[model samples]
Target: MTDPLAGRVLRGDRRAVARAITRVENGDDSTDLLNGIGKSLGRAFILGLTGPPGTGKSTLVDRIIAQYRGRKMKVGVIAVDPTSPITGGALLGDRVRMAQHTLDSGVFIRSMASRGWSGGLSGAVSEAIQILDAAGMEVVMIETVGIGQSDIEIMKIAHAVMVVTMPGLGDDVQVSKAGLMEIGDIYAVNKSDLPGADAMVVNLLSMVRDMKGRSPPVLKVSALKGEGVDRLFDAVEAIRGRFLSPAGEEMRLRSVRGMIVELAKKKLLSEFEGRAFARSVEVARKVADHKMSYEEAAERLVDG
Candidate 1:
């Protein structure tokens, strides 16, 4: 019945938070820690940032931390970096660009390795955000691995998904083909000072307009030069408010239901991967050899 993480994290202890995150990333079942932080939840706003590899998401997140800190708000950043092939550590880990805040006690930043996990986030991302949330961080930013199309999982964790893209990326086609144009609650065209930046914003607007009945704001920003970032922050608040507002209770309910489903799916996946999953690979190879149809292979897996 001794829960050490609960007290250390609630006391704003960085070491305890880091340990807890590592445990979660490795898929440890923190049933005790979960119950510890349950009452401490709902105070922090979770913001998710996801996009293609070269979208400058880390820089944008660094700027956002500064803005939030300026308002005297405590900020927590979970930057998901690609896992290194050999070492299996985070590739661009620790966010060197955001090094300025390393000394600031009000800002807590941690880089996580994707570890071959998809959906833009590592397995323990939501749990890490929960730790930060429980620690009294007012705003928690989850920056995905930024692997373009696989980043759809951000929608599951964020109250608002900021799909970050920049100019000269030929984003109009890439965004549409990647199926990311529909998942974002807010769109930010970064590097707006560059040429074709305005055009990119227009392209995003056109795509959003096609969604019909949903009016998510698309903005132009220069995360490098700090242009239009305040508006982006304001838009995040507005979008969250719109979801929690009187007229949008349905959306809130939907989000709750979605989270429940996500949790259930995670549990089931963990169970499947735990024992005799090698049988799945054996069956898959048989299917690949044309000895069985995919449907038959799936049924065999189910039977197993």
Candidate 2:
């Protein structure tokens, strides 16, 4: 069959952009499209925003997009929401906050369902980002499904990962449990106007100080009222500048290499499971039941 999504991706068509993202999210021929979209994708900066559920990640992303748009930047957003296991549906409520941008030609927003992926992202997210990059987006932001801890997968693909948190969410135990200290390249204390905001910053700073190596800059902002957003933007630009340099590029390349290796390992294991290994498993099961010694079974399989 002809690849309609690939055609649209290469042509930079917006509707085609949406369609390609849908195909990726649904795991429909995404590998072919991604292969075509690679190398062309390095042009866009991939920003990953992740955090606890109430941290205002979607609002902060919306504000950042608006700021980028003001500077004539083309923005692509991938908002990942959890899928209902029973219904396989996602609310996609983040898109509603960005409705104003719908009228702006420069902004493209696509929502993805996590489909029960354990790492707080949909399987299609990486390919979707490539499609946006190929479509000429200068910046692509991925908003992960906010599932407290175990959201570290975004760190693998994002050039910079932002961990967002709010005031009074929990104790120091909560912060540690969330895995916030290790994953964030930038820490955003969103909703700074709320009570206990300073305490939150202090706790984060204390944690960073203790960590002592490559600690991300922590900034406080109120996404709802736009307080401290300019500072947040400045910090983001500075972080981007530092990380996109030669050294930063090296780190990015290393990350990409690691991802490829992991993908290969996964694919190889899958292939082995479906082929020669299937018969091996049955033989191994018999060996386990004492039908034959393990060594004898292994020798037989190897000889066969």
* Candidate whose TM-score is highest: 1
lDDT of 2 by residue, 71-94 (tens): 999899887756422111222244
Candidate with top lDDT is 1
Q: Evaluate all candidate structures by whole-model CA lDDT and list the values in order.
A: 0.74, 0.72
| Candidate 2 ranges with C-alpha deviation above 4 Å | 1-4, 83-102, 118-123, 146-150, 258-262, 265-273, 280-304
lDDT tens readout by residue for model 1, 143-226: 774555435664566777898999988767777766677778889998898899888988889989999788788899988788
Report, for all candidates in order, the number of backbone clashes. Answer: 0, 0
For model 1, where is the 10-residue window of minimal lDDT? 84-93
Candidate 1 has a TM-score of 0.82
